[model samples]
Target: MAQDESLRDLYDGCYRRLVAQLYAICGNLGEAEDAVQEAFVRAVEKPRRFAQVDNPEAWLRTVALNVVRRRFRRLTRYRGLLRTAAASTPADAVPGLSPDHVTLVAALRQLPLEQREAITLHHIVDLPVREVALQLGVPEGTVKARLARGRARLAPLVREFAEDVEEVDHV
Candidate 1:
């Protein structure tokens, strides 16, 4: 496909999904959207190179994930100021994610970066383990291991979230 067509198709196929995937990883909707958009921009800048890649969606996801991670690391360098700013920012100023969703996102944030990425790619983005392996440049077995470890870590958090929901239902 031509460059323009490929970009259009990529936007159509992966834009929203990538944003959601990034949100799942980053726990910040604005950051997630920005990361995915930046990834798309980078992909467009190297259309020919990207076109030759085997799995474009995975490529985009990896790029977006890197962007988010880089942004987080940069922000962490100014952690004090960033935390103050984040605290002062109204909840409504942020995108409208539900409380439960926010809790789940916080749980994701508690995991190690690789574990979170592996879980997001496999579960949130619905990518196969092999594809996630390709995206992260790891072996499939590594992806499997990360997924297992991540799930084990997350299981209690998920159960807690579920219990919260059940309690709310009883109210």
Candidate 2:
């Protein structure tokens, strides 16, 4: 009973923030919510272990991030095997997100998963490079390289977006 109550409190406090973080990482709201929810469910399945954690929220975030990564890997494999099958796209943009936000996320989806993770954590989530490295379990130099590569890939897309905005303003 106590474990359940504490877990409930943690969920109420961290759910939205985790979802937003994961959404930025994954570029899809539904997948983000599902990942976070899966993390909580895992906590419920191992209450004693969860209670032993010193930083429950961080632990939850790690679990959710792992869930997202695993799903992406599995999906990639599935897609590779189904190359001849029709590709499905997300049905619509998330409501309440701006057009620029949508465009940026679409561009982000083009990045390799590692680079996308680094860029999202460092830039979108505003974590320091050291912290991003820690979260990703990569060396600082690797994180730096990923960030550089991601930025290089995104530069043209962002410049095009800016040009479109400028043209719209001029008209």
lDDT of candidate model 2 versus the reference: 0.86
The list of candidate 2 runs beyond 4 A from truth reads 84-92
TM-score of each: 0.80, 0.87
lDDT of 1: 0.83
lDDT of 1 by residue, 1-171 (tens): 577886898799879888878887877788888999998899889877988888787788889988988987877677766665443233233566777667667788778888989999889778899888988889999999999999999999888878988999999
Error in Å for residue 3 of model 2: 2.9
lDDT of 2 at 84: 62
Q: Model 2 Cα displacement at 147 (Å)?
A: 1.2
- lDDT by residue for model 2 over 1-171, one digit each (tens)? 887899999999999888877887788899999999999999999999999999888788889999999999888888789886434355245887777777787778778888888888888778899988888889999999999999999899889878988999999
Cα lDDT of all candidates, in order?
0.83, 0.86
Clash totals for all candidate models: 0, 0
